[model samples]
Target: MNAIFGWSVLALVFLDELLAVAAFGVWGWDRDPRWLLVWLLPIAAMTVWFLLASPKAPYGGPVVRPLAKVVVFGLASLALWDAGHEGWAVALLVFSVVVNGLALLPSIRVLVEEG
Candidate 1:
């Protein structure tokens, strides 16, 4: 049961990351200079993910890692809201909180640390 929940949470984290990038894309779609923003925003978001959120990221450390997650997810949620996806924005925020909360549980954390 612990392993199952851990894996599920991990999968959800991946899904959240993808959804954040998509949310940025959605926002860029409606802005001026669509050609640039449509591609650029997601690229920037991915760069941040690679630098501060990935498992092997160098700059994350302890504080910066969680802070980066908050910044990325927060911006993504705001982007969704700004792009007329109010419900989706709220849902994404709520989903992130719940998923991260679950992942931090001792049982799941143990599985992750061991694996």
Candidate 2:
């Protein structure tokens, strides 16, 4: 049970990360400099995730890592909302929170922490 739950949470985490990046892309699509931003925003988000939020991030300490995750997710959610994707924004926020919360559970923490 623990193994299944752990893996499930991890999957959700991955999905959330992708969704965040996609949200930025979606928002950028509706912007003035569509061509530039469409490519730039997702790339920027990916860079930030790799540097600060990824499990294997070099600068991701106990505090900074989680903080960076929150900020990134928050920005993504807001970007969606501002882009007239209010439903998607709320869904991403709620789903991200739930998955992150589940990842912190004692039983599943080990699996996620290993990332």
Candidate 3:
């Protein structure tokens, strides 16, 4: 049961990250082809690590690290949106980042047995 929930949460995290990357690629970066590869590399690396590490539940150092990645991606996305003069894109990206972060926080609490 815990394993299933953990995996589900992990999948959500991965999906959120992918959406962020894609958002950055499309709206934020002005659909730059080169930027797509650059944006995907860290996600690919994280996917590999997640598969190999095989956590029973989403806790510990690794879970926290992904949040940082999300923040970085969000900031980069904001910067790109600003560069492109897209105000709506910036708001949407920021909202996504906040929502993803909030979703992950509950899982962290569960993992830590704090709630």
Indicate whether candidate 1 or candidate 2 has the larger TM-score.
2
Clashing pairs in 1: none
TM-scores for the candidates? 0.92, 0.94, 0.41
- The C-alpha lDDT values of all candidates are 0.89, 0.90, 0.53
What are the clashing pairs of model 3? none
Per-candidate count of clashing residue pairs (backbone under 3 Å): 0, 0, 0
Clash pairs, model 2 backbone? none
Of 2 and 3, the candidate ranking higher by TM-score:
2
Q: Which stretches of candidate 2 lie over 4 Å from their true place?
A: none
lDDT of 1 by residue, 1-115 (tens): 5677788998898898999999999999999999999989999999999999776687876788788999999999999999999999999999988887787788877776676
lDDT (10s digit) by residue, model 3, range 1-115: 3645655555665665555555544443444565675566446545543544223334425765565565555654664575574675576566656655654565553653542
Per lDDT, what order, best first? Answer: 2, 1, 3
